[model samples]
Each structure stands twice: as C-alpha cells, then as structure tokens.
Target: MTTTLHVAIDSKTKKAVVFPLVFSGVILLLMMIFGVVMLLGQGKLIELNPNMFYKIMTIHGTGMIGVSALAGSCIIWYFLKQYVPLNTAVFRLNVYLFLVGVAMVLVGIFAYDFAGAWTFLYPLPAQSGGMWGKTGAALYLGGMLVIGTGFLILLLEAARAIIKQYGSLATSLGWPQILGKEKGFGPPPTVVASTMVCIVDIIALITGAALLSMSLINVFVPSFTIDPLLAKNLTYAFGHVFANSIIYMGVIVVYELLPRYTGRPWKSNKIFLIAWNMSTLFTLIVYPHHLLMDFVMPKWMIVMGQVLSYMNGLPVLVVTAFGALMIVYRSGIKWDVASSFLYLSMFGWVIGVVPAIIDATIVINHVMHNTKWVPGHFHIYMGLGACAMILGFMYYLTRLEGGRIDNKLDYLTLWLYILAFLGLTGSFLFSGKSSAPRRWAEHLPEWIPADMVAAFFGTFVTITFLLFLVRFISYSSNIGSKINQSDDIRPSTHG
Candidate 1:
C-alpha cells in the first residue's frame, strides 16, 4: 500500500483528470435520462415519434460508451502517470477531441435527424431512407473517426512510454513472470493492465477508423459500397472491443484503490500475469460470438467465438474479485462511499458475466442475442461494473482532496442507485426472456408491462446518478488543487 510513485503529478495534470470525471458524471446522468425516455416511448407512456426515439437511442448508446471511456481514461491517467513519464498534453488532447466529437454527434442526430444507431453498421449510414442524408452521416461518422483518432494517439503514446520505461511491452506485461523466468512479483498491476489496454484498444480503434472512414466515403459517394457481411464483422469487432475496453480501463481504479483502502499490497504474481494475458487474447477474438447469427461467418470462427466468449473476461475478473475478497476478508477496512462502490463494482462484474455467458452459447445466441438480453447483460456490466469504477473514483477523489465526508443522503442515494439499477436490468432480462425485441421504437401490448417496469426503474437510476453527479461537482474545486490556471495544450508539447 505504501508503493511510492516515482513521478509526481503536478496540480495541472490532476485537473486534466478531475475535469474529465465531472464531465463524464454529467454525461452519465444525461444519457440515463435519454434511456428512460426511450423506455417510456416503448411503454406507450410518452408520445415519442419513431424518429425522435431512434435519435435518442443513437445518442444514448454512443454517449454512455463515450463518456464511460472518457471517465475510464481519467482513472488510467491519474494512476498511470505515477509510474510512467506521460506527456499530459496527449491526455488533455483526448478530452478536447471527445468534447468536439460529442458536439458534432449531437448536431448530426438532433439537427439532421441521423437515426442510424450507434453501431453505424456499414451500409446503414449510406442508406438512411429519407430520415437522414449524406450530411448527417458524415457528421456522425466523421465525429466518431475524430474521437477514435484521439484515443489511438493517446494509446500510441502510452505504448511508447511503456516501451521506453520498461524496455519492451512484453516486459511491462511481465512476460518474464508469466513464462516462469522471473519468480517474484511482477510490475505493478496498473502497468500490466495499461499495457494490455494499449495493445487491444490501439488495434480496435484502427480497425474502427478504417471502417468509419470507408463508411463516411460511401455516404458521400453512393457508388462506393462495402459488403454487408464484411461490414457487420467490422462493426462488432470495433464496437465490442472498443466498448469492452472501457471496463478494462475502469478496472485500473479497482486495482489501485482496493489495496490502498485495505492497507495491503495487491501484488502481481504469475497467476495475475497469466490471467491478464489470457484476457487480452480472449477479448480480441471474442467478437465473433456477436456474429453467430450470421450463418455465413465460417464454421471455425463460430466455434471459436462461442468458446472464447465464455472465457473472455473471466480470467482477470476471477483474479481481481477473489483478490479483493481475500485482501478485505477480515482486514478491518473502513467502509466509505469509495470502498462501498468498489466492492459493488465487483458484484456487478460477477453478476453481469453470467447472463452474458448464457447469451454467448450458440443456441442461446440464436434465441436471445437480438432481444433485450444483450442490453440486459451489458447494462449491468457497464452500469455497475465499469461506471461504478468511475463513480468510486469520484468519491475516492473527493475524500482524498476535499476531505468530503458522507452525509445520510449519500447512503440513501447509493442504495437507490444500486437497487434501481438492479430493478432496471431485471426488467430488461425479463423482457428478453419473454422474447421482447430490442431496438424497437414501439412495443406490443404484451411487452408494455416490462417496458413500463424498466421505465419506472430507469427514472430512478437517472435521478440517483444526477444526485451523484451533483455531489461530485460540489467538490470539483478541491480535487487535488495544484491548479495551473492555464489548461491549454501547447503545440510544442506535441513533440
């Protein structure tokens, strides 16, 4: 727990993280509102036209994933800087690019009525019927490309710095430890995790950018076309990898903070190194599971997808969850908002993986993959798992820098957030079990009950997040105040 950092984070670098967190919190609440609105429309409680509903859906999916990733990057930057000599300018650039991309996406959706879902699956952008045109598709796809470029650059920098400091990426991932050459503790868990994320996300983002660029060009030049099957492959490969990577980045918070609160060391041993390496491989290859419904996707890929999907996140999840329990078992660790949320995040990951695995089965994928089941598993996974890490880090920061103490309302909101999220995800899973179709703007009378139930709970989830956001914003000023009034990134620093 007393692991001292070689590089000290100046006040300015701290703000780079603090600002992104607050922004992410604000976006979380906003996106949740859009979620509830979609549910209300499906439940027939609100008069949402199909166009408006789809627009909201596109933004909701895109915004939640984007904001969560932004928040996750904050966790990575905050702790990772302690180990590596990072150029804060690159980090700051990511946030800037995210904001600009978000603005363009907003205009594309609301102004131009871009109704293509976040999947942006190839030909769909070029063929939006009369709902949207080339301009809207360009804006949305271009926005995504811009965001992906920034993240890719940030990751490239991380990969470079890791190589510079540790001699190689393999060394940083503790290959020596995993191969039984070095028998002691490996690099810090943060380094190992960051290295894995860098490798996977860099590949994921580049693949996505290629697809996005082709999609954008196809929009302007209708004669240019891509094979739909190939497009779907690119879609899930990029979407699944990029989206899942948020949790990988978010988990850095868990690894860093758990041991700190428990007053124990979270060592990276051979088992831990092996688990991470396994996770990286599986995470990259498991996207094929998402395409099991496509019969044309070759037999071997289908078999491999189903097999790896079951193993995808299990390795690191098991180690982290078990390590957490062992470290805190009877350590008399003090309970607070941060600690509570950290533990809750683990519960989220564990519970979320079960249904995800269930859906990954070849048979179940045929039945449930296109239904609300997919959303049910991922919501809990992202909501309680990844988002909790960001929220925990928020509380963790408040306590560390602002000396913020919990009020009764904090506990009340925590209970409301967890229970409400459970209620919402439960309704989603139930809807899937009943064969309710997902991504539909309107629901049949039979599905309305579940839709309404989800809407009811979704409202609370959004409201509780609003409270959480407000709380974090209240202390944004004191979050490690080494303020350099100039937050600008100088071009010279780019080199």
Candidate 2:
C-alpha cells in the first residue's frame, strides 16, 4: 500500500481558490505580453501610437498589481484557513467583484480612451486635456472603488475571524510576547503575517477608496477640487502600501513551506514579533519617500519619509531571509521546483532592497528617481520576490495534490528565467545610468539599443512564463482530488 499526503490547506478552500488563481495566472500572461509590446514600441521595432502606448501602460500597471494582489490573497487565505475559520463565500465575493471591476476598468481604458495611468494623480483625471472624458474617468475610478469594496469586506471578515479565534489583533501580532508579558514562541507565523496584512490593508483600501471617491466626484463637478499635494500624498500612501502588501501576504507561503520542507519549525520569537510590528508601521509611513521630490511638503515629513524608507522592509526581510538560510543549512532538504522557488524568493527580496535603498537617499533620488532606475528597483522586488513566492505555492499545490512530476526541462526553464529576468532588469538599470527618462513615449537612438535589449529579454520572460502557466494549468485539475480524507490534513515533509 502507498500513502499520499498534501499540505494542510483544506480541500474546500483549495477548490474555492482555483478560479482566482487561474484568473490571476491568465491575466499575468496577458500583462507580460503587454509589457513586452511596450518594450518593442520603445525599441522602435514596432509602431505603437503614443496614446495607445500610455493606454497599454495604464492597464499593464493596474492589471499586474491587481492580479498579483488577487493571487497573493489566495496564498494568505489558503494557509490562514488552517489556523482559523474563513468563510469561503467571502473569498468568492472578492473574485466576483474583481472580475466586475476589471470589466469596468477595461471599458474605461479601451472604449473611452482613458489613460491617466494607475495613480491618476488628482486634477489629471478631471482635467484630462481632452485625452479622455468624465465618463471614462468615472468608470475607472468607480471600478477601483468596487474592487476595493470587495477587498475591504474580505479583510474585515478575516479580521473578524482572526479576532474571534485569537482574542484580538494585538494578540495575533504577539504583542504580549514582544512586551515580554508572555514567554516562548509567538503565534504561528501565518497568524502574525495575516494580522499585519489585515490591519495595514484595511487602512490602505479605505484611504484609496476615499481618494477614488473624491476623484470620481471631481470628474463630473468641475468646481469641486482637492489640494494637489494632499492628493499626491494619498496616492502614494495608498498605491505604495497596497502594492508592497502583496509580498507581505505572499511571504506567508514561505514561512509555512520552509519549515515543513526542512522539518524545522519556524518559531516566531519576541524579536520576530517586534520586527513584524515595525514593518506594519514602517510600510504605512514610507510612502512619504516617493514625495521627497516635492519640496512643498513639510521638512519633517520629508526627513521622516526618507528615514522610514531606509527602515521600511529591513526588519522583516532580514529576519525572514536569515531564518530561511538557517532552516535550509544542513537540513538535507530535497531540491525540487517548489522548494527552489521558495528559496529564490529570499534572494530576490534581499537584492531588490539594495537598489531601493539607493533610490531612497535624498541625493540619489534627486538624480535617479525619475529614471528607469525606479522601475528597475520595483521589478526585481515585485517581479522576483513576490511573484516567486506565489509561483512556489502554485507549484507546491500542483505537486502535492496532482502528483506533478519534475523533469530536467523544469529546472532548465527556471535557470533560463533567472538569467533572462536579470538581463531585462539590467537593461533598465543601464538605461537609467545613461539618463533615460521613464514614462517617455519615444526614445532617442542612443536609448533605443537598451530598449531593444530589454525587449529581447522581455520576449524570453513571456515565453518562460507561458511555460509556467501551462505547467500549472495542466496539473491544476488534480488539485483537490487527492486530499479528501481527514488524515490528509497533515503536511508532507517535502514533495
């Protein structure tokens, strides 16, 4: 007789998440192709109208962030469910709202020709300079609100469930442990991470919803207005934090999988709890760094922004990465697709931090903040770090339940992906070093070569990602099939 086991994420929740993950994966492919097309246009290899370029750029940014968040939510929900009771219907509602909102956003962008970009930045939406009209702006902003409403409800529900189980958010955050009132390891890492995410994202989505509501009103009522500075502050505060939260949520997968893989429990100590708490605070405040370019902001706020940006991701990244290395060292863990990607996420996160720190400095930011350097910074972090964690979970799920087998091609594909992604980000950094301005529709001849190089690498990335999605889809059918019995609730040590 043979025995098979799956990760402890329950079967019903796995079935519930299938559509969202599939939707996320398919949309990711579409967005990547849009990214490559943008690179091609910038490279002079294709003829793309300037307006159309910005429009694609708009959807590219919005779609990527939205879907990544959607995918990241799946990871959080899948694991957190093991620790607490989460309503499957609430999770399903988020996907439904996401789809409806995406349709509205599409109509706004393609049908109505609205291309104000994801951040929109206040008056631009109202005063589009004839690039778009009120209806288009309203649809986009309103769609975002609807999507945010769903997430807000979902998060509130998570918080409710967490509080019900753990007594309170602070307890889940391990405040008692950090304060030394309680001893031993803190709450399970999933609880700590989920608590932090629920708190921060609830605040962020509300802030964004308010901003969207105001912007939506301003779209039709020409007399109504918001201070540009306030709008900028709100925009980055919401955008920066919401986007960064994807990685924070996705990292839960690492905390769970690594321990189970190496058979080393990832116990949360006092310091770990403190670090997560600090991250919660810092992530909320660090958006000021993006506004460092605007001198009108209070001097103290500018200083705080830069200071917080330096400290923003350090606490959590340091602990998590160090813990990962310690877990894998001498553990004799098997080298497989899921574990490999989980480990790679650590490298991506740490490396991504270096460039961000550089850009956060007042002097460097003054020089390089507007260059392709900024894009390069986030691409490494969000692309490699957050995306890797999600991909690891995807692969982990398929393998455990579907019995997906790994071949040399899978490893080969991974290698190609690493090198190719490095190649793409390298071109962006080089172009920035050469002083190429970001968000420009056209590039000069000197910059064209770098764009061409980036496009070449981008092509490979899209192809490789297609392979990843195909692999996931092929095995996705077996997801909830093999893990039905009550005994299957336990996690396998490794695949």
Candidate 3:
C-alpha cells in the first residue's frame, strides 16, 4: 500500500504570491478608475487632452491585462503548491521580473506618453506622428518583452513542477485517464486547468516576444518595416490568446475553491478533462475573429475563426457553469464574500459569451466590429468575471486563517459591484446598438448620455472596490500572522 502525501506550500512562497496578488488587485482597481475617467473625458463631460486620453487608454488596457495575468499566475502558483513542491526561488524571480516590467511600462506610458493602445499595431508605434517619440515606443515594446519573459519563465516553472509530480504532460492533463489506460490520481481539476493554461500561454508569449522584437527593430531602423497584415495577425493572435488565458486562470480558482464552499469535490472526469483540452486548442485558433473586418485576411481563416469561436466556449463555459450550479443548488452552502463572488463570476462568463458569439458572426462582425459592443462584451467578461474571480481568491486567502468579515457589509458591497458593472456594460451595449463607435476620444452629442451613464455606474464600482480594499488590507494582515501560527489548517479544504 502506498500513502500519498500532500505537501504544504511554504510560508515564504505564500507571502511572495500574496503580496503580488494584492498589489495587482490595487493596480487593477486603479486602472478601472482611470478607464472610467477617460471614458468621461471622451463623453466631453470633462475637458481632456486627446493625446492624454489615448495615453491613459494605453496604460489602462495594458495594465488591466497585465494585472489580471499576474493575479491568475499567483492563484495558479498558490494552488499548484498543494500538489507539487515548487521552486520558490523561481517563483520569486518571476515576481521581480514582472514588477520591473510593469515599472518600465508605466514610465513609457505616463512619462513619455506611449499611446498606441495595448495592441501596438504595426506601424502605429513607429508612426506616432508627434505625440510620442521613438524612444517611448522602444521603451513600451521593451517593457512588453520583459513582461513576456517573466510570464514565460513562470509557465516554464509550472510545467516543470507539474511534469515532475505527474510524470508527464499527458498525465498532468489526464489524457491517459481519458483514454482509459491509467487510473492515477487523475490530476485534480486545478492541475488540469493550470497545465492547459501553461501550455497555451507559453505559445502566446512566444508569439508576443517575436512580434515585440520585430517592432523594436523597426523602431530603431525605420527602413525595416514588417508586413502590416502579418503583424496584425500575430498581434491579435498573441493578444487574444493572452486575454482568454486570464479567464482560464480564473477558472482554476472556481475549480479549486468553489467546491469548498459547496461541500463538494470537483474532480477530474472525462468531460472536465476533455473540456480543458479543447480550450487549450480552441483558444489558439479563435484569433481570426479579431481580423474578420480586415478584407485582406484569407477567407478560410475568417471561417476558421468563426467556427472555432463557437467551439471554444462550449467546453469550459457550459461544463463549468452547469457544474457550479449543481454544486450550489441545494448544498446548504455558506455564502460569503469569497464564495458569492466566485459563483457570480460564472454568470458573467456566460452572459459575456453571448455577445462574444454574436460578434463572431460574419454579418454581425461587419456591422459591430468597431462599435462599443466589443468593449461592452470584453468588460462584461473581464471586468465582472475575471476581476471577480481574482478578488474572490484574495478574499478566500484573507479569510483562510479563520479571519471573520462583516457579512452584511460584504454582501452589500458585492451586490453594489455587480449592479454597477451591469449598468456600465449595459450602457455600452445600448450605445453600441445605436452604432456608437469605439476608441474615439470624443463622442457625438447623441452618445453623450450613454457615456455619462456608464461613467455614473463606474463611480459605484469605484466605491465598492474602495470598501473591498479596506477589508482586504485588514484581513490580509491576519494571513501573515496565521502563517506563523498554523500549520495543520489547510483552507483548501472548506468547512
């Protein structure tokens, strides 16, 4: 008989992961506030510099993506620690490199006004007209390079740890079990989710790195221009995969934590394993939808994008959403800040997917491609879904050490956050229905009311997050203390 042991995550490692998670949460909050303010300026409610608006837009978009990815990494690392012993040194290194990259990006955007938006689409950075110089472009792209390096290293570390523990990637992803050849521990759902994301993101990062390198070269040698179509494809290919992975990261939180609240175990079954495996492949193939409006794109690629877009959401969203509902339906679960947010995020995921699928349709894409619908769909998923997952994980950690929170206040703030976000995204959808264009620094008089409504709801969101931050700081301090005091209490096991 063999007894398997579950190793404890190191206190130092927990500290490393927690600090970054909280810091990224703060960055995420700030980005949202700034984004809302920028939208207000676009509405012309407040006078703002057009260049400054784009500059803030650049930072807000990149910062939100970066912070979401960082938070997801932390969640994966912390949970992965339970199944496999991780190299703490490598984990810390990832943190240092990521923060350094973030700093460089902030300087490039704020100090020098690198306002090409997050995509840094081909020729835009180099041809900034007069708003930003070559150095700013170089700095921003370089920062992305650094950030990609950190994430690549992090995924590599995760792969190493998973393979070491499970013997092979096949086993880690439960392919053997899916094939009926093996009956191993079958890889927990979190392990399966993390493994899938690691593989996909590694590929995404490589694409990102290749493009950034080319962009940097062009920045210095203006004569060496790349193909705009090739650049756009690679850029969106990387960007779409990277953005999708953020939700997958959040999914692990649902897999690992939601069970605890519902007193159920989310194990690796055939459907679960198959769903994740499909996600890994479809996420890569769905980038073409972003290029549907580009007439130069190959017709076959556009069709592939539409087909894959429909397939990609099927496995994860349907399975996870249904699975979550089953767990909570009559489980007599305790609904706290952490569990409530986690559960509610699934609704965001599903609701957001409806619009995403609609937009992927070829006819719809022709009309709505550049409308506010794009932002509306994205914010619905990421703002409400991914952010909610990260915040829920943070709250879970703080309360892990037997820390108590005010139930009334937590529920109030959660509702406020949800309602405000719905309002904000609703405003976007309504405006988009009226053919409101996106990425405009100024809006027409007809669109003014929509922008103002979105901005108004955004304020409620800001207030809710402010309250969350206070509780986060207060309770997180207890986590550090609890680390020193308790060794047997694994909050991974819900009461």
Candidate 1 on 1-495: residue-level lDDT in tens? 333211257666777788888888888888999999999999999999999999999999999999899888888888888888889999989989998999999999999889899999879898887889888999999999988988998889989999999999999999998888878999999999999999999989988999999899899898988888988988888899999999999899888877766667799988999999999999999999978988989989999999999899999999999998997777767678877899999999999999999999999889998899889999999999998898898987776665567789998999899999999999999999999989999889999999999999999998899988888898778766733222111122111
Q: Per lDDT, what order, best first? A: 2, 1, 3
Choose the strongest candidate by TM-score. 2
- Cα TM-score of candidate 2: 0.96
Where is the poorest 10-residue window by lDDT in model 3? Answer: 1-10
Between candidates 1 and 2, the TM-score winner: 2
What are the TM-scores, per candidate, against the unseen true structure? 0.96, 0.96, 0.95
Please write out the lDDT profile of model 2 over residues 1-495, one tens digit for every residue: 122234566678888877798899999989999999999999999999999999999999999999999999999899999899999999999999999999999999999988999998898988999999988898899889988898898999999999999999999999889888988998999999999999999999999999999999888887889999999999988999899999999999999988776767899998889999999999999899989889999999999999989999899999999999998887767768888899999999999899999999999999999999988988889778988898888888877766677778788778788888889988999989888988887999999999999999999988888898888999887788764223232234433
Which portions of model 2 miss their true places by more than 4 Å?
1-5, 483-495
Can you tell me which runs of candidate 3 are displaced by over 4 Å? 1-8, 183-185, 483-495
Candidate 1: the clashing residue pairs are 11-482
lDDT of 2 at 304: 91
Displacement of the residue 464 alpha carbon in candidate 2, Å: 0.5
lDDT of 2: 0.89
